[model samples]
Target: MIYVITIAIYLIGLVIIGFFKAKQIKTQSDFSVAGRALTPWVLVGTMLATWMGTGSILGNAGKTYQTGMAGLWLPLGSVLGIIILTQIAGKVRSYNKFTVPEIIGERYGQVARLLSVIALVLAYMVIVSYQYNAGGAVLHTIFTDDSGVSAISVETGTIIAAVFIILYTMLAGLLSVVYTDVANGIIILISFMIAIPIFLVEAGGFDGMQIAFSEMGKPEHMRFFGVYSFIDIINFCLPGFLLIMGDANMYQRFFC
Candidate 1:
């Protein structure tokens, strides 16, 4: 019940923020771009929250659980991509356009813009769907009884998540998203700060983990490659690299 309450409180705080921000949304530009007045720190927070989604917290974490240290390679591609993006971030921001397709349209043509829009729509739809699933999974985990039955079904949780996300986005557009993202970024940072040490201590540190893996007959789990071939690493990495490079969310933040 405490866990559920905490989740509810967090969501209620976001709703309150959205409500307040909506009052300031008098025009399309204000709603879409926060009137182009976001502080550097808010931009940092938004970027962190945008990039660190279900893929980072659940997908990559699960891969790491299975593959051990080699799972780090999965995110290394995105890290490298972000580094490359930094070189062009200033240029992207200077374009001062509303969206990635706008910049592409100016550079290429209407045909290219239409193609980019189609691609972005497809990609974002998939991202949002999985995000809803992730939200549902979170709720299921939180509400499941010791007997393994959940108070609410994953489908119901998914519907709730989808409704909240759609309504929140519609309320104040990017203004609400950026503000809530700042809060989320702080929460995530604080969670890592508190959890990592506790986790390491409970696991008895790297040497303990190594010994445990050896005893479990899974010593390969401690290795850098972790039973995966070089080709497998490349394959795991390339898609994330390419996706991050072309991610519309990150580019839209840059535009803001």
Candidate 2:
């Protein structure tokens, strides 16, 4: 009942926010680029929140669980991406493009734009599918019940989340997404902060965590740069860094 109530409240809040923002959306331009009027902080918040979704949360958690500290390098890569992006912020802002493909097409030509669109669509669809799957998993865990309704409950919860996201996004575009993302980021940060201390207390504190880690025989897990050679870091960073150098999302944010 508590779980249901919590989810109901969250859904209601999201719907309310969407409805309120819906009035602000007047055209495709407003939806797609938020009238290109986003401030720097809003742009940064949205980019960070969007980038740190299910793929970052669940995927990184699983990886950290399996490989210990070494798994953290993936998120560290994103920090580097942000730093690289800062250097080119001026250029990106100047481009004033909607999609990455548009920017690429303008810079490289029609063929580049066509290829970028194909790639972007595939990437975004896969991301959306994964978010759906993750939401279902979270709902199932939250509303665990042995009655055969767990599956149905989880699926229903997932569908509800998907519908909300689709409707909110469809109604207002990037403006709504960016504003909601800022709120979402704050919520996630606060929730994690509160949960972590509670979790630590429940798990028996720092000594308990140490004992647990020792029993798991993973002392090296605490080191962020452990086991990564210079060449390895370079190899992992090179392509991604280079790609962001020309990323369309970066350009769009700049234009806005």
Candidate 3:
């Protein structure tokens, strides 16, 4: 009940924030690009929050749980992409376009711009679908009673998440997202710092963890790329690589 209350308050808070921020959205630039006024830290925070989602938390964790060191492909791909992104970030910002499609139209032509927009819409739909699903999973897990009864079904929780995110994004757009992401960024940093040590300890330290892995008859799971073929490795890494490189959200942040 307490956990439910806390989450309810958090969602309500976002609604309140969105309500206030909506008043400030006087133009397309303000709504979509945040009026190009974000400083480095705010931009960084929004970029981090936008990029780091269930894929970073539940998705990556599940991969690591199943594949051990091989799971790193997801994050390692993103890190490599980010290293490359640092170079492109400045150039992207200079374009000062409202969206990635604008850049595509400038660099290529209308057909390319149309294709890019189509690609982004498809990618964004997947991202948002999973996000809503992840939110539902969170709620379903948290709402399970002591008797193992689920107070909220995953579907119901998903609807709740969908409504909240849709309303929030619709109400205020990028301005609200950036400001909220600032706090989310800080909280996530602290969560990772605290959770890592606890997880390591619970797994019985690094050496114990290795022994447990060996006992699973999957010692290769500890190796780089493990038993995966070169093609398999590339396949695993490509989705993340392509997604990060093409994400319009990051482009919007840089433009800001």
Candidate 4:
């Protein structure tokens, strides 16, 4: 009940913010770049929320729970990609394009732009599907019956999430998204800060975790490489590294 109420309030807040921002968005530039007047902190907040999605909170965390430190390889790719992006970030922003394909169209051709659009559409579909799945899982968990059966079906929850996202996006474009992301980034950071110490304490600290893993006959979980091979690490890293390098969302943020 608490979870449902909290989520409901959050959703309501987002709607209100979207409507408020919509009034300010009178032009294409205002919608796309928030009038090019966002603060550095706002950009930082949006970037953080943009990068850390369900893939980080749910997928990577689940991997770490099951296979331990090996999961670090997944994010390492993104971290390295970000490091490289910093070098060209200034140039990207200076280009003053609304989208990645727009920039590609200028330098390359209509053919490259079309190809990029197709590729990005396919990639974003996959990304959005997982986000919907994660949102559904959260709703299902929170809306369970006394017997532990979910009151809300995953499909219903997924549709709800999809509607909310679509409505939010259509409301005010990047203006609302950046503000919402700033709030989300702060919440996520605070959540981690509060949860980590409690998690360590509940698990009886690092030594206790080591002992527990040892007793479970999976002491390798504590090792730097966990149970992953060199090939496994490379496989885990490459996709994220490559994705972040060409991520249209990141480029859009830069354009903003």
Task: Tell me the whole-model lDDT of each prediction, alpha carbons only.
Answer: 0.89, 0.74, 0.86, 0.87
Give the alpha carbon lDDT tens digit for every residue of 147-198 in model 2.
6456446677678678888887776777777888888788788888999899
Using lDDT as the yardstick, the better of models 3 and 4 is: 4
lDDT of 2: 0.74
lDDT of 1 by residue, 140-244 (tens): 889999999999889988887887777778899999999999999999999999999998898889999999989998888788854778889889888888989
What ranking emerges by TM-score with the best candidate at the front? Answer: 1, 4, 3, 2
Off by over 4 Å in 4: none
Better of 2 and 4 by TM-score: 4
TM-score of every model versus the real structure = 0.97, 0.83, 0.93, 0.97
Off by over 4 Å in 1: none
- Per-residue lDDT tens digits for candidate 4, residues 1-256, read 8888999998888888899999999889888877777888999999999988898888889989888656667798899999999898889989887888898999999999999899999999998898988888888888998899998999999888888877877899999999999988999999999999998998889898899889999888787664788888889889889989999878778887
